[model samples]
Target: MEISFTPEIRRAGLAGAGARLLGVAAVLVSLLLLLAAGPPAAADTTQVRALLHQGQDLLRAGQNDAARPLLLQARTLAQKVHFEAGEIEALRVLGKAELVHGSFAEARAFLTQGVALARRTPGQPGLADVLLALGQVANEQDDYPGALRACEEALRLYHDQGKLRDEARTRNGLGIIYSSRGDFPRALAMLLPALHQTQQLRDSALQANCLTNLGGVYFRNNDARKALYYFGQALPLVRRQPDQGALADCLTNLAVAHQQLGEFRQAEPFYQQAIAVSERAGEQAQLGVVLSDYAQLLTDLKRLPAAQTTLERARALLEKSGDVGTLAATLVALGHLHQQLGHGAEAETQAHRALALATPIKDWSVQESAGGLLASLRKRRGDYKEALRYTELAQAAHDTLFTQSKAEEMGRLQGDYQLSQERERAQALARTGERQQQRLQAQQRQLWGLGLGLAAAALAGLALWRLNRLLGRKNQQIERQRAELTELNATKDRLFSIIGHDLRGPLHSLHAFVELLAGPPLPPDKLAHYTQRLTHTLDHTLALLENLLHWAALQMGAAGPPRPENLDLAALANENIGLLTAAAEAAQVSLAHSLTGEEQAWADPAAVRLVLRNLLANAIKFTPAGGTVQVSARRTGAVWQLAVADTGRGLPAPTPLQELRPETLPRRAGEGGQARSTGLGLQLSRDAAARNGGQLLVASAGPGQGTTFTLKVPVAETVEVPV
Candidate 1:
């Protein structure tokens, strides 16, 4: 039926009775069937089944909230009946209802149990259906890979059973997964097959779903023309379907496609239509999404007031539904709209809220969008520093998402290419066999002229030998170049490692001591203590610098490292900690040393000291005031382990670290609390440890926790001085 395109409809409230009546009728029919097959003379079971049927009807009508209690009642009844299958079904339906209600955790618990039960039922299509539901749950949670796997498994089982319609449904689910992951080609591949199946089956509802998915894939792939084409195809099918939900989705897809094409007039109507359908169906979540889409469209169209109002309604609906992800997105849209309307404070508030929500979800798209909006707001308010921070975040988020998508696409393309190559090779082999037989027949006749053939062959062989020799020389040249490049990279890494490890001691000492001196004067005893500490710090700093300079010169092909020397790592760690004690105490942090007994490491003493000093100093700096920095050394088999653990701020999240590489080591923090380094300390420690026939490991338990830097060095029996 024709739904009204109004603000109320956009908020996801039901429209006129026609759509509701049909949904109710469907629910009644389903209930009747369920009752007819249910236990005889069980009034409680009947009532529960009826309520469940009513919920399903309400759900079909898009009245998620109204359906929730009924579904809950069904679950309670199923539990009372102790019917395992019935309970599973009740849980499954309840989970689906909860999903629509945005009760993700509750939904997950129900669906997970349903999946387990379904899996237990051998040779049943119910398992595939459960898998499909699980996939949708995962999709809602934004666990794209999990969703993809679930959908793939469901599709496989359905196909194996020759359940074409179920397979089509599963394929549509996969399309959604691939589309969300930015794998447009794969999404299209999935959607097209499902679309074909649905068309063959003449399932209008399924057809609409497939078409909508296809349209989304096209939209994401930047093929607006194709997106519009698919969306238009979906619209007619959705119109014919009894389910207005499909119609709503189709309308939204079409709107998005049209919007992207700059067909504002066409887009507006579709968005309005989608909102009307969602409202009529009482799908608040869907309605919120539709409202956000329309608001975004309005904002793009420069209709600020309308956009703001639309965004507010969407936000409210999302908040009511507890859809934080969508709510955040709505906030971001609202922020942008407010910013456009010159409302600075309002914009900032919205932007901050958006960021708060977006950060936890780890949805890069939402994060980037929120970041951009926040950056813009900051810039408009003349807060350049804050603006720059947000801008960088946005850029980083964009880069990460782009890189991930590109890598996945490249991997898929590579796989496809390899498969195609194998197929072609197989075909070529078959053709070659046929040709070889023909050649053998010809060769039989040619055997009579063997002497003439041999003379020509001998000349050809001599020419081939000369060409082979030339190619061999070229290969040797290429190999030599590769070796040179390898050596250069090694030299570069060595230089960086030295620079990173060696500079930390002096630089840190200088920074800390400067802070000390700039502060109020201390008593005579404390002054003397400071002086002694500063002197010790200088000695270690100078030694590290000397070694670094020498290493750099050596790396530049200028002189040499005499040879590896046996060094006492425990002594080195102790010496460095002694130097750092004053600075650590000045920061109100305690240095806990636990190096017992001597462990000799086979390395340049200078290099070992640098590694130990850098690690200790880093721990001290990052540890908050009153936090303890613990340094310990122990022998593990042939290696000496030196670890510096801090009870302070830990390492940042793993995501930023994933981008780090050897060359990018000694990473320095930018303006954003990012780890700033040339990423050198760990790399330097690693190199120094390796030089002594060992390795260095750095581990952190996330932000604000703690960090441990361990240096594993090979034990040496005798002290050997570098000649």
Candidate 2:
């Protein structure tokens, strides 16, 4: 049960795991040494076999880009000669090369063709080899569950074929996949016999894969020291048989491990080596995943702009390869970079895009990174409830990754495997001479394997228990949210009640004023007063209805998709000022704006207009005759702060941003003899601000002091709108 752990290259280029910079590679697998076979034709099967062997050897030597031509040639020759097995072998090996190089779509194409050919051929289940290649491809693509099934079936077939070599390779594939999925117990269980089995074989490829994958488990478990130990052990072996781009990916694994250990000087060379190797091999995954990881090291070195360029290059490379798993990680890295650069909206877009491509290829690191960033962004914008949900998502990923107890258990599992391997070694030595020692040592190996097996079984139970507890907690959280929703519905009913009562007066006044105007032939002054009153009531009712409808639409989630744009704040404010000038004049309030003309925001222009109109109208209404309502704006990091300050009867107290919640009643900006407002305007403004990726903040000194309502919206750095 001697397990050489492969460096599970955790994708740290993703935002999750606090940038530990990668677990080892899931798809940096052993290229299968497939045996070629076919009926003799004009072109001898032997020549085809030789070509396949040479190409596969080059593949094993870490030259996939170099090997692909040869493999393609073999497939062509086999196809011409009607040798299905040879064609299938070539296709399978080609798929293997592509899969290891992080070209999943191409890999699947090749593997699917191999499967089709194998199914049509009349022979032993050639499907096993093809299935193994498909499984490896699937695993690298982040379709772990699918991969596990494919590999398990391949494992059964390999056993039936009595191919211990193939079986060990399949099992090792299973181990790496299990490790990728955060299933340490199952990973160890698979790796134990696979590593033990490989030790008896003369295959450096399988042995290197075993050790490298075992290292991956340690990396996932967060035991960087132990992870480094296994990675260090596996690298030379990986170098010996650098299948596809395993050597480059292995270099990345070493870099991250060293990076995690704070050995940047040591980490840098490995990262450069990985870049060089991946460049030489022209493998996108290594260049994409590993180079992005190397960018993080640059960030650590305080080379921010260079890191940005490096990350962009990695992202561009991945975008072309159709490796969504790697692409998602790259997006996560880009989001993190945006976060560092104070581009909140851009960062959010990147994270959401990463989250949006939800396929079976579930990279927890991508989920973790995306979730963590989203949570932070939500919190920054004062949406604690949404933040909490994202925080829970991040926490779930973090907890599943590894706990101290889980790590301790894995350590024990490793010790058990190590002990059995030593016992087997002892048994081998004893068998050379001492029969008594051999018998005792043989018993030790069995005992060690059995004991570790039992421990792994116990861990399975523990995992189930933990999962159930997590599920129960999740259920409780769901139930709690349901209750909150119920409360929100009730609160909405109350808000409707209030809106209805407020609308009642305006409507009744409008009806009575219209009737009086229609029926009465009164004195000139009286008729004029009635006409003015009727018009005033109509305007008030229309304004109330508009605000009420806007509120209702937002609450009902029927507002449709946002139509955000890069809006010039100064122009928009000027337009609003022109629209509100008559009202300002009627109220004898002087309206002024201090927009420097360069202020701009990224927001829905329509929504922003409503928000600004509401705030300004509220200010004008609250201000006494001869008072001033002034509009001003300033840039604040990644947002624009537009403030409407009014000389009026101020708020009773300072209103906190948290008080802007829907559940909280809006505090009137002022309360004086000047005018009475229903307070819906402020609420409408607040809601509109929130919808536009902004918030309306209220500040006031107690009664009669001026109030300032500042609307915060995302800054428009360019014409490009965020998704």
Candidate 3:
């Protein structure tokens, strides 16, 4: 059975295919015409035309200062002669020159005036050019949406006029606008076609611009080799033209591409050439950027001295020119350079300044760089906690940049996929046109299924990408926790070792004294001596055990808040002196006590008792035979100061009070060589005092000179007692 092919179905398929074909064909034709379009006609007067030409020539050569006066004269003369077209052209040139010199307001004023004049004139010939200049001004000011609007309008004008060359240039401008927004794929799509059209027209200057823009897109996309290839192709073309500014930019890009690839040796000469060209043309802004980049290259090459000099030069130029964008970058490079030179303070200063400058501008690249440098500087200075903070900030910035880059990549891929889908849709329509009516339905169904499948695949891919990112973050967190656990385990083992080492001597002495007491009774004199010795030994052992318990409580985070109460500083001092009096007499050390007034203290009573007992015992033990130990208390404003002074064997040298840890304290024999120390008592005392809102300070003048221990605590308020 032969199936009839309905005309209605055929027409439907043909119409759909034809519409898509027409749209594609129209875009291609428009691009071709733009490539062939000639330059705009000359101004009305010979003098106006000459002035405009000279100004444009000078502007192309990066001599904006020299070109401004000529353009101004042309504008004035054209206005005087009532030459609207000439005035428009002169205004356009002046606006561009002003824009290049960092005068956005003046450029906008001139360009807006030119646009207004072109509208009032009969033909409005210069309107598109004025709009294009305004778009560039918007781009320079970082107004992306404004730039896009202006460029699109100019593109429409050029398309309507069949001005292919102007359209090509506008397309390149659109690419640059997209690039500034970090949309690299969109940028490349606009730039590549423009480059092809410019090459076809054999416009050397335009072609060079297109090549440079393509290189920039590739550079931003991290395609360094392709960027290098395009930059190399543009270098000779820019040199051949009269555009010194373009040549300088080309040279700098080449140097950057090489430097990124670790080809520093090959990059140096290009940087030098770029710097020389910018300097000769008096392009201070461009010179500063080039010098800053060169300094970065020098810093990477370990040529620190040269990098510093170059950075200083760049800083001076950028500051004078008010180029904050480049200045921020220069400062980041300077910070890194200072870090490499071991000037930590200078590095930190520069990094902070860079962050401050870049933050207001929202220059994320500069901010990220400065944060990284600051992190490194902090780490080098041993400020690890603060270094970690900067590191996290830098990482966040890096992730943001990476996400932006990935989005651009996705946009490019999506654009390509959409183009392919359009082609397929057209092809399916063509096939439908050839098929019978019965098969047409089947083809339609097949096409719908294919589109749905493609969409589903795209969604799945995006979902998988997101899932992978989440897993990566989770893995990073797990790794960090694992490292922390490892460190904690090491600390636990060290603590156990210290506890065993400290407790061994005291335990052994206590065991020996217990065994002696349990043995047979002795004569009266011998028994008295044994009893006294055993008492001292038992006290020393008990003190050591208490210190260890306190330390363990502190380590375990079980030392709860201190219980503070009011107490007489003098009474506490006398109590401790009496407690240590027996030991002092046994050592043949004289004990003395003195107090003035009430000398009340608001402190944890237990902590104060431990502190006093430790200090008095240490003084008595360290004192030689016939040495005197003096305990005194006094009131100083709203604070109580207690001093424990001894004519004892002092510390061998000056030791920092802050560094008086248990491990650092000296273990020495007493006067009779019967008493030995564990060195934990002083550290424990200090820790206890600190917990009670008090401080223990030690002063010593070397061996054989007396040492004094001063304890300071807040005074308690006066309270009424029973009459």
* Shift of residue 233 alpha carbon in model 1, Å: 2.0
Measured against the true structure, the TM-scores of the candidates, in listed sequence, are: 0.53, 0.36, 0.41
lDDT tens readout by residue for model 3, 34-61: 3454543323366667677766766655
Q: Go through the candidates in order and give each one's C-alpha lDDT.
A: 0.70, 0.73, 0.76
Question: How do the residues 1-723 of candidate 1 rate in per-residue lDDT, one tens digit apiece?
Answer: 011111122223466787667556655765666667645547656666677667766776677766776677677766777645555667778777776666778888887888887676554426676677777877777665556666777888989899898888778777776776676778788878888999899988778767777776777788999989988987887798787877897888888888888899989988888888899999898999999989888888888898888989999999989888889878977887777788888888888888888888887887888888877776656554466567767766776676566556654544445446556656866875676566555555565577957755665567557656865786687679768866875665455444443344345445545645665665677667656656655654554565565456545645444356677665676678788888777667888777654666766776677777777766765677778988887788887777788887776653221311345333433221213344344555555556556577767677778777777777786755434
Off by over 4 Å in 3: 1-127, 137-146, 279-285, 302-325, 352-723
Candidate 2 weakest ten by summed lDDT: 21-30
Compose the digit string of candidate 2's lDDT tens values, residues 1-723: 111223342221234452221121211111221233345563356656767877666655565555677788788878887888889889888887776676789999998888888888998437898888787777666655557667877799889889998889778877876776677888989988998899899677777778888888888888888888878878888887746488887888889999998999999998998898888998876688887898889989888889989988988898888878878877888898889989999999999988776325656667877988998898778654476567656655554443434544544444445445556656755563365445445545655577776765566567557756865786687679768766765556546455545566555445544544554355788667656655655665677788888877887788886799888888999999999999788778999898877776889999989988988888887788899999998876897888889998776665543335433544342323222356677777887777767887877775688778888889875854334
Poorly placed runs, candidate 2 (over 4 Å): 1-162, 242-244, 301-306, 315-723
In model 3, residue pairs whose N, Cα or C atoms come closer than 3 Å (at least 3 residues apart or on different chains), thus clashing, are 33-164, 34-164, 34-165
Return the TM-score for candidate 3, rounded to 2 decimals.
0.41
Model 2: residue 20 alpha-carbon error in angstroms:
46
